[model samples]
Target: MERRKGTIVNVGSITALAPGPWAGVYSASKAALHALSDSLRVELKSFGINVMTVAPGGTKSNLGNSSAAKYDQTHDWKYYKKYEEGLRARTEISQGPGSTPAEELAKKVVASVLKKNPPAWFAYGQFSAILSVLYYAPLWFRDYFYRLVMKC
Candidate 1:
């Protein structure tokens, strides 16, 4: 990352900060990007290379509609079935009405890349805020909070 001089907008997600029901893998992947950005920023800052991390919130897109495994409701993880309704509800969030238009996000992203002084990290939309907190919270705090919020 330090070898070149250019802007790198790493696409993170609310999942990275807050890992919740039915999307552990997705969240972890995004979280990895966030962590990577944290390291890369310092490593590349002196070289005039801007490494920014953008965490997008809920937006209407096909990303979640098509997940890793589209297993039928009849066949699911044993313990997970107990929280099936909650899982479905959480999954629906990405496609919910509050979703920021994808184009809107893309436009902002492009503008950020073209900025004279781009932000170190940019988070847009709903869950992005929660994820930021989760990224800084204690382990017990995050776990208990999730349990209380989901009632599971």
Candidate 2:
């Protein structure tokens, strides 16, 4: 659709806004994607292309199971061994009951992208709002809350 102008939808993660424990690399990657999307929106505007950044929170899927299955929790850490359970739990945390259904999120994203004037940023899924709140919260508050909840 280069000639007709098209929308470029980039899927990111809500964790990019406020990274917590055991997911620093994942969060940083998503954050970089978000930043790239922002830049692309400006750079591609004259080309009749729309850039949208969709930051999903936690949607139900096999991600947790796959991660848990592939992860080797047997690794012996020198100092962070005490937090092993917490690290292991990170793989399954997004699969909790509160996660949004993957199909539901997909439908919403499709509808949004098809709109005549799609939003530049769309975020949905479980913990989406809470993470947004944490993004705006004070550093100390975020640190304490993440420590309490993640046990890291």
Candidate 3:
């Protein structure tokens, strides 16, 4: 890496920006990565390395299906039993019809990262805009929106 300048692309999720119900752990992990990327970007700049954080929203992929497979919606719950279906649905939310194709996102990322001046942050895929809005929205508005959408 010291011989030649290169870009380090860190893939995160939109959840890191505006976390919602039933995916706190996942969101938190991604948020950590986002933070790390931000710090690394500055720390590595003097070394001729560019760090780019990619926060993808809902993109078409098997991740959702795989996650849904492992989820046991039938399991007994102590507090969120009433929201079982909603919780399970969280895993499949990104697989919806409007989700962006993974290939499309991949191509964009590749092109962006290869540029002489790559952006520090690149966010794409469905729900990216909405999530960004939620990220900047008032706390009460975000809370109300999530409650209404999650039906919780």
Candidate 4:
């Protein structure tokens, strides 16, 4: 009734492609996962294992609320105290009005993963396309764009 292989799906983030001002650690972690998945896709191929990386953008989830709650707990900003509001706003960036519905993203992921020949890389959600494009943009341009949007 069902067929399942040894597939490893790493849930990455579109943020990995473009590191923003207040989300350094989150972006870095996702970027690291992307790198790991890339390597594993090849390394595990001979063993009949497939690795897929899903890079989701602003999809509807409780992550924004959780991030906000965590940010609320931190009071010591020191040198970065003046930009607290912007930092807080960054927490809710993925949960904005334009955010993708979680169900939609789930459906896409499931459909892709269930295919006979699954893809090695997949990205979906609100800012997915733009962020993918941003991956190819110049460093200076990306920096200016992030600074303008994140208000850093």
Candidate 5:
């Protein structure tokens, strides 16, 4: 804020770490947000407004089921019908037991925000570690990994 010189936090998704099949648009949007946050972090530094980007991997929520339901209701894939099962599975992949609790992520984010020197980049929750690995892997390896896991 101009008055108080507060922090700006942008919440992105771990999916933005890599561009893969099935969720390309979503990934691109999140990726754009991350980029914007990075730029803002520098541009707003002089104003004493800290910018932080949080890329949550998978927090516990009903998102998976809701996504599946919406996809099933709205999309009737004629040519890509063969990949329907895989697509559906992708929607629910993050709502499993391995996901970090929403409350836990909230607490961590709040704690970080309250800190005098909050982290510029923070990533937490399930699938975050593996996703980071994928992000750092070579392009070829990342492609292979996604092909294998996403059934692309």
Candidate 6:
């Protein structure tokens, strides 16, 4: 905490606000961090700390693909296989569709931080758009959504 000065950006997922079945635990942990970020922003305000939480949508990264691969190898998705196509589509976002580049995301993040009066919360990308809307929808709607998109 002492090592850094100025702003502290905590990376969270859009799923932190609203979770899906495939990553319930991951979303919960991120939600915890999101709460912590909110708390610290208030606590450290007197000390001139600018805390911002970046709820990045699905950015292109190798980690998600690797996890999916591992799951394929070890997870007996006998049940989930029913939703195999949907699962593949959902997981592919983390691996990217080549539409929104990672470098572009980084640039936007950097630009946001560089602002003198930066937003306390910021989101970007296609999944961000989808998530922002989904975050407000009714629970049943969201459930139906997961079933539809995940094809469960």
Candidate lDDT scores, in order, read 0.79, 0.90, 0.90, 0.87, 0.87, 0.80
- Candidate 4 backbone collisions, by pair: none
Q: Which 10 consecutive positions of candidate 1 have the poorest summed lDDT?
A: 67-76
Q: What is the TM-score of each candidate against the true structure?
A: 0.81, 0.92, 0.93, 0.91, 0.92, 0.87
Clashes of 3: 0
Model 6 TM-score is 0.87
Residue-level lDDT tens digits of model 5 in 1-152: 55748899999999899767788888899999999999999999888999999999888788777878876566566766788777886887888778888999999999999899999999999988888888889999998887788786
Regions more than 4 Å wrong, model 2: 1-4, 77-79
lDDT tens digits by residue: candidate 1, 21-55? 56788888988989999999989888889889998
lDDT of 6 by residue, 33-144 (tens): 8999999999988777888898888877786777668657755788777777776776675666643567888899899998997777888865777777888999999999
Candidates arranged by TM-score, highest first: 3, 5, 2, 4, 6, 1
Our model 1 lands, by Cα RMSD against the true structure, at 2.9
- lDDT per residue for candidate 2 within 38-101, as digits (tens), equals 9999998888899999999998889788877655644556466688788777878889888889
Give me the runs in candidate 6 sitting further than 4 Å from their true place. 1-5, 96-99
lDDT of 6 at 26: 84
Model 3 scores worst on lDDT over the 10 consecutive residues at 69-78
Clash pairs (backbone) in predicted model 3: none
**Which of the two candidates, 3 or 5, achieves a greater lDDT against the reference?**
3
Q: Candidate 3, 66: how far from true, in Å?
A: 1.9
Clashes (backbone N, CA, C under 3 Å), per candidate, total 0, 0, 0, 0, 0, 0
